[model samples]
Target chain A: MFRPFLLACAMLTVSNLTRPGLQPVSFAVEAGKALAIVGPSGAGKSLLLRAIADLDPNDGDVSIDGIERRSVPAPRWRQMAGLLPAETGWWADTVGAHFTSGKPDEASLGQLGLPGDALDWQVARLSTGERQRLGLLRMLMVQPSVLLLDEPTASLDEQSSAQVEQLLGDRLAAGNTIVFASHDERQVARLAYAVMSIRDGVAEPPEAVP
Target chain B: MSQYIALSYWDVVLAAVFLAINGGLSLWLDLRLEKQLLIASVRMVVQLLLIGIILKWVFAATSPTITAAMAAIMAVFAAREIWARQERRLTGVWGYGVGGGAMVFAGVLVTVLALTTQVQPDPWWSPRYALPLFGMILGNTMTGISLGLDTLNATVHRERVAIEAQLCLGATKWQSMAPFARRALRSGFMPIINAMAATGVVSLPGMMTGQILSGVDPEEAVKYQLLVMFLIGGATGLGVLLAVGGGVWRLSDERHRLRLDRLQQTR
Candidate 1:
């Protein structure tokens, strides 16, 4: 098993980011590990991810590496816990414009199978898979300790999906935590060390992968 | 010097004939706007006549309290107009307060500045000068503010996801919203910019035209019109800037979170 041993600690912790009358969701992801949240459509999977990112208003405590999310300023907290929505929004005219930290790393772009001139491409012309990959790359540039991704590879084909998985594997290998929601069985089997199933806001406590 | 032409009530009735022709055309085209035209004409007549009577009383009274009260009332109505103009308003008091407060603040501040510094009426609050100047500024500022608020809220709603994405990328609320604020300000300022550009060439400004019609010296009227235009421009710019800022403030929370839930669509 590939496990990063740099900093052994609970990198991402969620102590009930759920509403009343619903089962409270509580889980912890150790450094360099990935947790997959799987459930049917409209099962509040995205909502849970948003809650953990503190993107939405919700009850419960979310912390990173022993520091409560509220302790740090929101922008800093968001930087540490970067979120990639299923459909990322591109407001600027060019892809490079969306990247705030100048041009993104060319190596990361190449690893994602994006062309060398992809950053110069107009956002209106990018394919769905390209957008998703760019969104991931954009989030990665921030170098968040925890990556909150919603369907990170849903828009990609088998080859592109594998490339993304490989890139994410490298991130995990570097001791970054990942909490992602996926519907793909293969993705869950391949990436996650733990699996959490949520249905209609009720979440089962995470179980270890066999 | 040409004498100011005083039109009798019968002459005013003759002027209504032009509106009657407009109503006739609306009926012919099945525009279904004849009723609206009639009601609007009647309302305009009543409103203007009432204002005329009130102005006569106010000018005769020559009291600072009366002039200030009339200015306050005009400002309040302008605020109400701004509130009524938004399609999607900030959920509560913020909807009225943000734009309304901007206009009243800008309008009064600019008018007082002009009166005390430039226009310099005997008491500075003289109704003749203060009322007209304040009314013009309030009207222009109202348009600018309402347009700004509308553009800000609409763009924010349309680009909610994009803004959230920026926020997710660790952008502070102001940073995430800077572009939208710029767009809103442009929308707010465009009207005055166009008006200023086209004032003499494309259209005669109402105040200057009224002054000329009342037989004021052309050069003197031009100076007054110039002063009025400059004052309106300053007030509109300040009003729009403040309203847009307040709008951005209302739409977000202290944690730099974008709170789209703060908006309510009125349709």
Candidate 2:
């Protein structure tokens, strides 16, 4: 019954996120800004991302624009503020089944380096890189206000990775806020407007991208 | 129908011969189940004899309290059996309550309907008809709930990410879990469907066979069996529905976040 106004300038916000093995972490990214989270494996980058998305249980306040996470339901919040997990899960047999609108945009599919006929292919036959790319495409199809991407290009080859970065840049320019976790600092240097580094239970306040 | 010949004590021994032969095969094949077979055989006789004595007393007395108590006790056992079979369950007595309550609800509904309608025995609560009918319905319904719950748990565990993705897509909790719930219900109902399909072809069902052996008219026996099967079908549908429903409810928090932690992993 509670319909929110269409969020323009998706201002990503997080406060006091406390989950197991992670300290209470907080940060905010201005609208259209990309915040890169860099940490070693097992450093709780994924946990923090999940917490911010309200996927896992954590004590935190996460909001997009002025709308609080608790104000809307978790399902609605996650839909408006989407999280692409490290290893994406596919439940349906074909690529088309994942999308609610029946078919993913063929042009966007090409942008993510997927063939136009990719939607017709069985999900089981997808290579890890293909799945990863399609997973991002699937998340992007919803056009969430905020995006939590866990290594969006971790499985992509260099050429495909460039395509993804360009696609994400296009989305961010369209006013999406992003928090992505990766060990790739060069990528951070390339795309991030701010950076949050985690090491041994320590999290830095958001710093301007160096 | 002609009068049925009663089985003698020697006839009981003739039944035991099958058990003896099974034990002998275990011994010869080194399957190492001789002690287990021997103990099961002994336990069977003891348990059946004890139950028989109790049932005899129950039938003679015909007290509603005692009848209800017996059914409740059986229901409790069936519920506990369902709880034990589930690898993941709601913590504490909730699992027991969900499983037991579903079976009891379905059983009572079916039983009361049958008694007031098709099966109006002389005393209304005739142990001869009520006990067996209730037992059969409860047993089958309990099996269905157990299967339904197990499938629900496994699906929730296996498809957590996919479900969460759906939630991320603005789907309601029910929308996210509806497909899995349907699958679990199918798992639960498949056995009953198979039995229905195989009835009279694969094998004569138990109630019909027993009634025929007891010198009931074949037509009368078949009719009773058919009615019981229909009642069993309704009871099973309710059982699986409630079990899967309760399971999915406990799976997620009110915030619509998946609370997998609420389910204890028995594996």
Candidate 3:
């Protein structure tokens, strides 16, 4: 009976975000679906993702399920629609300190190809690929219903990228909606059910991934 | 008490001769600081002279309202000085209010507490006691608050990515900003801590030295200086806390978002 009415609604809906030299854009992501945003460099893919997360200021209406984003407290909204940026920032000395719930799930870390002892390691010692996977794991720990990822696998090798994609695929199977921006067409074809092309600040309507 | 030795105006003019050496050195070395040195010396003389005259009138009037007004004037100027010292300032009224307001709050609170509980002058708000105590507290509080606020905003600005990352994970604004706030407060407390440590050994504090010069017992002067030090330490800590708290508030919003746009580069 918890939000029984909103069960039928799209997981995420964004409408009319206006930017100079950028077309007004709007779209929706259905429950359990993945929408891949493919674009060239300087095409504002990250900007679109940030705007949707409400991390950056933009004129738009963004809603999770049937609830408007503004109606919920921002932190709660962010939890529901978590964003994973290209290069996630780490401030603490150890990786474990970054986790709010503390001591991130060991199974989840293994799924992302991280060792059990990774949490105790200093942040300065982490490789770029490790950081990317760990960042995704950190975001996943919050269990956002809708994941906004900006080049989630940009730094990973083929094996690591496969692991990440496999992890994301599991989340998808579990009914979480995903909106990801990537330069990798192969990743788009593998993961995204639908695709949107961003060109010169304009996002074309979503279409089936070829 | 020993007889106070009052200095004539000629004595001060003679002291001014000491500055000529610096001015001469600057010119000889081609450091090009001669003009600045001269200007600084003149400004200091003029400002101190003006304050001396104002203090004389203020003491003669001896009205609480006049005393409060004088304190207010000093606080306003201190606030402006705090505002101007920032590299990336909080925009709008906040740029002025956050640090300025903290300095005034801490300064007034500690000074009043000391006056009432310790000194207990006949009127409690006696101009002679109140004015100088407020001035010392305000000066130290201003430094702590300004340093704290500057550290806070600058660190937040530099660490926006890390802060935003925490926010995205559903952390409340306070949770995300706690580390930086702690760091800022530490920086703010450093100056006062060092000054206190060095008060007797490396340096004779200005207030104690002045008291000794004005025929006060050396022991009495030392006691007063200790009181001043403790007051300043408490005021600085409170001021730093308030300023950094205000800074964190200004940098974030109700939505738990880091609004770095609230800061602007000062010219």
Of 1 and 3, the candidate ahead on TM-score is 1
B220 in model 2: Cα distance from truth in Å? Answer: 1.1
Once fitted onto the true fold, the runs of candidate 2 whose alpha carbons sit more than 4 angstroms away are A1-6, A200-202
Q: Enumerate residue pairs that collide in model 3.
A: none
Which candidate wins on DockQ?
1
Model 3 Cα lDDT, one tens digit per residue, B1-267: 467887898998888787898899999999999999989888998999899899999999989999999999999999999998888899999999999988889899999999999989979999989999999999988898888888889999999989989988988899999999999999899999999989899999999999998989999999999999999999999988988998998888777878888999756
- Per residue, candidate 1 scores C-alpha lDDT tens digits across B1-267 of 377998899998998898899999999999999999899888999999999999999999999899889988898899889988888899888888999999998998999999999989898899999999999999999999999999999999989889989989999999999999999999999999999999989999999999899999889988989999999999999999999999999899877888888899665
Q: Model 3, A1-52: lDDT tens per residue?
A: 0112223324888889755545778988888789999989889888888887
Taken over the whole model, the C-alpha lDDT of each candidate is: 0.89, 0.85, 0.88
lDDT of 3 at B15: 89
Q: Estimate each model's TM-score.
A: 0.94, 0.94, 0.90
TM-score of chain A of each: 0.93, 0.94, 0.92
Q: Write down the RMSD of all candidates, one decimal each.
A: 2.7, 3.0, 3.6
